[model samples]
Target chain A: MEIITSNQNSRVKLWTSLQTAKGRQQSGSYLLDGWHLVQEALNQAAPIQAVIATEAQMDEHLADVPQGVPAFQVTDEVARHIAKTNNPQGIFAQTSLPNNSFDSKYVHAGQWLLLDRIQDPGNVGTLVRTADAAGFTGVALSVGSADPFGPKVVRAMQGSQFHLKVIKDVDLATWIDDLEENNYDVYGTTLSDTSVDYKTVVPEKSFALILGNEGQGLDPELLAKTSANLHINFLGKAESLNVAVAGGILMFALN
Target chain B: MEIITSNQNSRVKLWTSLQTAKGRQQSGSYLLDGWHLVQEALNQAAPIQAVIATEAQMDEHLADVPQGVPAFQVTDEVARHIAKTNNPQGIFAQTSLPNNSFDSKYVHAGQWLLLDRIQDPGNVGTLVRTADAAGFTGVALSVGSADPFGPKVVRAMQGSQFHLKVIKDVDLATWIDDLEENNYDVYGTTLSDTSVDYKTVVPEKSFALILGNEGQGLDPELLAKTSANLHINFLGKAESLNVAVAGGILMFALN
Candidate 1:
C-alpha cells in the first residue's frame, strides 16, 4: 500500500476535479464518498478505478476490498478535500458512470418514473430512491434535469443508485410516446379539466409516472402526450405537495 | 423606510442573530429568508417582529407589507447576512415563534403526524410539509428532534409552516398515551409480530401516525404505546426507504 501525504499528488488532483460535472466528463469517472457508498459500489461490482482511504479507514475496511482493485491511503487533509460532506468517513472510490444505453423503445415492461426539468439534485435523488423502494423497475430523467450522478444526488440516493436502473438524458416526450405505444398507463401529474383523481386510476403492473419541475408542471408537449393527467387530492389548504413527496405517494399508490 | 447601510446597524446584527437557535430563543423570534415565506407569514397573520428588504425588493413589494409593521431597507450585504440561501430573493421577515401550548390532553379529532427524534433538519421539515399536504391537523416534534424553526428546516418547509400547526419540543411518549386515551388511532412505523400491513388499514378521519428516528427507528417506549404498529411492504431490493419518503407514502396510505 502506498501512503499519499501531499495534496499535490496527481491522483489527488484528479479526485478533486471529479467533484465537478466538467471534470467528471473529462475524466470519465465520478467519486463515491464515505465508507458505505464505496463499499456498496464494490459489492455491486461497479467499475472501480481506485479506492482511497485514511489509514484508520483502511485498517478497518481493507479486508473487504477485493483483490486486484487499486487502493491508496491519503492524509486527512487530502481526504477532506475529496469529500463533499463536513465530516466524511475518510474512505472513497472512483467509478466510471454506468453505461446507460436506455432508450424507451427498449423499455417494454415494468413500472417507470420519469422526471422533466427537475433541477433540484436532492429531489431527483429522493424521487429515484422512492421509485426503488416502491419496487419500480427503473427511473428516467429528461435532458434538462440535474445530473443524476452529481454528488448531492449521489449522497441523497444512499446507495439506491446500485439498486435499480437510473436512465438519464433521454428525451421525455419520446419516452412518453414509446410507453404509450407499449400500452402502458402514462400518468402525468396535473389538474386540468380532463385529469382524473389518482385514486380513480387502478394500479397497473406496467406503467409510467411523470413528475414535473418544481415550479412548473410537465412541459405542455409531454403533458399532451401522457395517457391521462392525474391529480393527488389535497384535503387541506396546502397549495401543493413537495415534488419528491408527491412522487413518493404516487409511486406507492400506482404501483 | 429606514435604510440600513452598515452591517453593524443594531437591527442588522439582531436580524443576523436570528439565524441561530440560541439567538432565536434569546430574542423570541425567527427569520423568514425569502419573499414567499415573508408574504405567507403576513397572509397568515403570524406574529411579525420586523420586515427587512433590499431597496429593489422594497420597491417591488412595499405595498404588500402590512400597514404599521416596522419595515427597513438593508444593503445587499446585509440582506445576504440575514439569509440562509446562497442567492436569497432579497426580502426577509422576523416573526415570533407561534405560541403552541399543546398538551395532547387538550386535543382530539383531526389527523396528526408525530415525529420522534428525527434529527435531519431537512427530514423534519419535509415530514412537516408532507403532513400539511396529507391533510394532517398538526405535527408535534419530540424534544430530541431537530428544531422546527431552524434555517434549513424553514427553507425545506416552503411556507407549509404557515399552513398548519407545528408544535415543537413536546413529550412524545406522553402525547401517545393521551391520543390513545382520546380514542385516536396511533400508528407507529415498525414491523412486529402484531404490526399490520399499512395497506390493510382503511384510511381514518382521525388518527396519529408516529414516524421514528432516521437511523434508530422509534424509541422503544414510544413504539410500545401505539394503538398499533404498521409496516410498509416493499417488493424490490431496497434495504429501506428514506424516512421522509416513507412517511409520505404512509400518511397518504393510512389517512
Candidate 2:
C-alpha cells in the first residue's frame, strides 16, 4: 500500500481533476466515493485504476477491496480535500471510463433509452438507475446532456453504470435514423395532439424511448422522426413531471 | 412600495430567519423565490404576507404582484442574503404557512399520499409534485420527513404546494389506522413475500399510497397495518428505485 500525505501529490492532483466534467473527459477516468459505490464497482469487476481511503476507512473496509488493485492510504485532511461532499465518506476509487460506443446492431435488437440533453446530474443519474431497473439494454446520451461520470450523477446512479451499457456523445438525430433503418420502433415523449397515451400502446420486444431536456420537452425535429410520440395523462396543475420521474414511469410501464 | 437598503433591517432579519425550519415554524411563514413561484402564489390567491424584490425585479414583475399587497424594494446585496441559491432570482415573497391540519372526513374520502420520514428535500418536493400530477387529494408528511416548506423542497415542488393540500407533521401510523377504519385500501410499498406485484393490483377510487424513507423503506409496523403491500418488479442490478421515481410510477399507474 502506498501512503499519500500531501494534497499536492501528483496522484492527488489527478484524482482531484476527476471532480469536473472537463477533467474527467481529459483524464479518461472518474472518481467514485462512499462504500456502496466502491463495493458495487468491485462486484461488477469494473476497471478500477486506483483506490484511496483514509486510514480509518482502510482499516474498516480493506478486506472488501479487490485483491491486487493498487491501494493508497491518505490522511483525513487529504481525503477531505479529494471529496466533494460536506461529509466525506473517506473511501474513493478511480475507475477508467467505460467505452461509450456501441454498435448499431446492438441498438437494433435491444431496449434503449436515448436522453436529449438532460442537464441535472441527479436527474441524469436517476434516469440511468431507472433504466437499469427497467432492464433497459443500454442508454444513449446526446452531446449536451450532463456528464454521466460527474460526481453527483455517479452518486445518484449507485453503480448502475457498471451494470448497463452507457453510450455518450451521440448525435440522437442520426441515431434515430439508424434505429429506424434497423426496423426498431422509436417513441419520443411529447404532449402534442399526434401523441398517443403512453398506457394505450404496447411496446415491442426491442424499442427506443427518447426523453428530452428538463425545461423543454422533446425537440420537434426529433419528435417528427419517431414512430409515435406519447404522453402520460394527468389531471393536476403541474406543468410537467420531473424528467427522471417521467422517464421511470415510461420505462417501467412500457417495458 | 417600501425601500429597505440595510441587510440588518428588522424585516430583512425576519426574512432571513425563514431560511430555517424552526424560524419558519416560529414565524408562521416561509419564503418563496423566483417569478414563477411568486406568480403562482398570487394566482392561487394565497396569503402573501410580504413581497420583496430588487428594484429591477419589482419593475419587471410589478404588474403580477397583488395591488393591495405590501411590497419592499431591497438592494441586490440584501436580496442575495435572503435568497438560498447562488443565482438568486431577486424576487421573493413571504407567504403564510398553510394549515396542515385536515378534517378526518377529507382523509376518509379522498386519494391520499403518506410520506414516511423521507429525508431528501428534492425527493419530498418531487413526490408532492408527482402527487399533484396524479390528482391525489392531498399529501401527509410524517414527523421525520424534510420540511415541505424548506427552500429546496419548495423549488423542486415548482409551486405544486399552492395547487394542493400538503399536511405536514402527520403521524402516518395513526393516519393509516383512520384510513383503514374508513374502508380505505392502504397500499404500502415493500419487497417482501406479503407484497404482490404493483401491476396486478387494481386501485380503488379512494385509496392511500404509503411511500417510505430513502435509505430504509417503510417501517415494519406501518407495513403490517397496510391493506396490501406492493413491489415493482424489475431485472436490473439496482437494489431499489429512487423514492420519487417509485412514487411516480405507483401514483400514475394506480390512479
Residue-level lDDT of model 2, residues B1-255, one tens digit each, is 789999899999999999999899999999999989999999999999899999999999888876889999999999999995567989999999998767555465768999999999999999999999999888999999999999999999999998889999888888988888888999999965457999998975579999998988999999989999999998787788999999999999999
Predicted model with the maximum DockQ = 2
Query: What are the per-model DockQ values?
Result: 0.76, 0.84
* Most lDDT-accurate candidate: 2
Question: Which run of 10 residues does model 1 chain B get worst, by summed lDDT?
Answer: B190-199
lDDT of 1 by residue, B72-140 (tens): 998888788778456788899999987778779977798899999999999998888888888888899
| Native contact fraction (fnat) of model 2 | 0.82
Candidate 1: tens digits of C-alpha lDDT, residues A136-172: 8888898889998889998888778888888888899
List per-candidate RMSD values in Å: 1.9, 1.5
The structural similarity of chain B in model 2 to the true chain B, as TM-score, is 0.97
lDDT of each: 0.87, 0.90
